[model samples]
Target: MASFKEEVYEHISAVYQTAADEIKNGLSLIKEVWPLIFLLFLALAVLIWFAKPAPPDKVLMATGTGGSYKVLGEKYKAYFEKRGIDLKLVETHGSKENLQHLIDRKDPIQAAFVQGGMIAVDNLSGVQSLGSVDYEPVWIFYRKNTFNEGIHVSDRDIAKLRINIGPIGSGTHAQAVSILKQNHLTPTAPNLLSMNNADAVNAIEQGEIDAVFLVDGYESPNVQRLIKNPNIRLVTFSRADAYTRLLPYFEELGVPMGGFDLGKNIPDHPIQLISTTTNLLIDDRLHPAIQVLFLEAAKEINGAKSYFSKAGEFPVYMNTEAPLSNEAKFFYEKGTPTLMKYLPFWLAEFLERMFFLLLPFAAFAYPIIKSIPSYRTNLAKKQINSIYKDLDKFEQNTIQTFDPNRRGEYIEVLNDMERRVLASKAAKLATADCYSLRNNIEFIRNALEKQVIYKGR
Candidate 1:
């Protein structure tokens, strides 16, 4: 016998070898099933790609003139870069054109800055709003004294003269027409001229037009420039509260006297303007990821106080004609998706997509895994039972036949069964199954030996 230490080492080595063999066999089984695994994941990938698909690498945004939306577009471009996506800003005339771009099938526009009250939810069924971002205050700049040069006049007197109500396909134009119509001054009444912003500015400066209408923020470069000019007077409504009631979407805002330039005392008195919000709207066709991305970007850029809004007062779900986007609604309800809060954007998106896929995948795969052992064991049982059936037939034949030659044949069949049983045990039948085969073989041998079949029947 080997020494105790040597014997202990041998036992440990044997155990290790057995473990290694088992591990090798497991790997071999996995290798054999690789195609199945590949097909499963491939199917899952297809489902996820189709169902909760990842957003494209690029998106399109529609922004309007006067450097207001241009600044917002640039901010979104930088914001999307951190998430490894590109934001392409397409310039348009104004809100009406922006909405036109968003709703058009040929246009790849995903998001836009649209004015409130322009679209009714019933009319523009394909578009959705994220939230109202900021005030696009309807600014009416005109030659202050042109109505009665060297004399005094009133609002109606100024209204009778020609005015630039903005180009036809513009947000300013839409609101201007509506407001003018409210005052019963139709844009088509020949007193209103449809001119672009630059043209409108020129028209007013040169006395070609009495007034120019613009829908923009108080801080808009054009608004600021016009505020500083002596000839161009900002339109102030003393009856702002009454106008707000007349147009529900309009907010009554007071522009303090000389707010633009305290030193110059530009206004000389407070100006009240009726303003409507500019909403970030998305077409129903845009991906949800881009929708959420735009919402987040809008919050950071537009949520701060301008001359009108308080801090965190913007990007609000203002009562509107268009319905809100799903992602925007969720963002308002739940803040942010939980996974996205901790992980990088792309990774979080990937994992979120996979979670949706894997839930269904797991449901599909569970039954197949659960049935595997039963299927294999039944196959092995059939092999053993086949030999058992042969044994039963041999014994019956012996009883019916009296020939000695046939009896020798019966013994030979038993020998063949014994060999088959030993081979099955060696091949990897379960311990209990192998023992059952051996016991059955022994029982048959006893039958043969005990003259269950004899030369003299």
Candidate 2:
């Protein structure tokens, strides 16, 4: 018999009442779990504080003034630039200077290409290795006219000749000193000269120097230029095995006949050379993400086949004077991280940090989450008990007063108490207790009504 407007109004009222009840319940639930919520936020804040910050946007690497090291650095720079990072190449004299830069705590250099045998493994403290990238052959080029044809080059012959052993801080200089000392020759020999790669190459070409000791990759411009030069001759290490025995870091490499130029039959016979590994070293404090990026760049750029290396043969763990980095070890063991393979570098790094951050938090939060339900139930019970205490006081007052004239007022008070209890959010959770309370209120009301009837009679 209700009109449409009346029905609509009633429906709207019911909807509003339901919404209000839900909001009240939600607020009550939040109150019960507020401590847990606070704890979770605190834990998150701690994790974020301790988590490794995002990788630096700009990184500086030490490379040689001009040679394969600089070229390799340029390649690495290109790789990093594609991933939204700036890789600045700092020009150094060579491996010794590069190693010194890495060892200096105040230096901004984070990475460098260090040759094997330059530093003793036991001496390294602040630097670590990504891996060996390639072979740096010790190319001893001499003017053919200086040494008779078919005459084996001897240490005495090299000791007497004017030779450019590279600049003071170069790997060529270091190795040249070591090799000369092993041959009972001193670095202070008047014939030994210190010169840069270009100057040294020019000296040898113009016949200013008898020979030059170059420690560089086969693909290096200076090495290639010397290889193609008709007047210059590469000295074959006849005692290569003996040298490798004395210098354990040196490896024997064989260059097949006509390897440099088949058409001209350059080096017409097979040659034996002693070489050391080109190690990629980084500062111990470098960020792990950046370390991983270096490893990946090594894989992409240095993993290819070259005259001295097979495809996928490089970026291998070898001749590392310093301990291998954790990131490098992980890379060699597991390959690139799965997320990095598919995601953008920055996004992958963010997700990786988030994953590490959340993993421990999940472990920490599991027990707390599991206890929430029990906590919520206990909170409801506590609220119900407080209401019961109020009811008990009211009932005790009613019993003690025993006023029949005010029995109607007591009934009204009981009705108000019932309405408040039913409206309580806790009442819904402890439904049995709520029903029992309502029943008790009704009983009190009935008792009051009966008392009033008896008194009236």
- lDDT by residue (1-457, candidate 2, tens digit) is 9999999999999999999999998887678799998898899899989998889999999988778998899999999999999999998888988898988889999999999998674456889999899999999999989988777564446778899998887789999999998988889888999998899999999999999999999889999999999999888888989999999889899888888889998887888899998999999999999999998899889998889889899899888468898988999999999999999999999999989999999999999889888887777788778767887898778777667678779888889888988887667677887888789878878878777434533
Which sections of candidate 2 miss by over 4 Å? 1-32, 121-123, 152-156, 370-373, 393-420, 441-457
Q: Could you give candidate 1's per-residue lDDT for residues 1-457 as a string of tens digits?
A: 8999999999999999999999998885555455556667787777766786788999888887655777777888999998899988888887777887777777788788888877663457588889888887888887877754443232344577688888887788888887877777666988888878777887788888888888877667777777777898876766667778888888878778677789998677777788888888888888887787777777788877777889888788884778888888899988768887788888888888778878888887777667556545565677778777877787677678746556567667788987886776223645577677778777767766676635466
User: Which stretches in model 1 have alpha-carbon errors above 4 Å?
Assistant: 1-24, 27-50, 105-107, 147-157, 359-379, 386-429, 445-451, 454-457
* Residue 342, candidate 1: alpha-carbon lDDT: 89
lDDT of each: 0.77, 0.88
Query: What does the lDDT read for residue 155 in candidate 1?
Result: 36
How does each model score on TM-score?
A: 0.82, 0.85
Residue 245, candidate 2: Cα error in Å is: 1.2
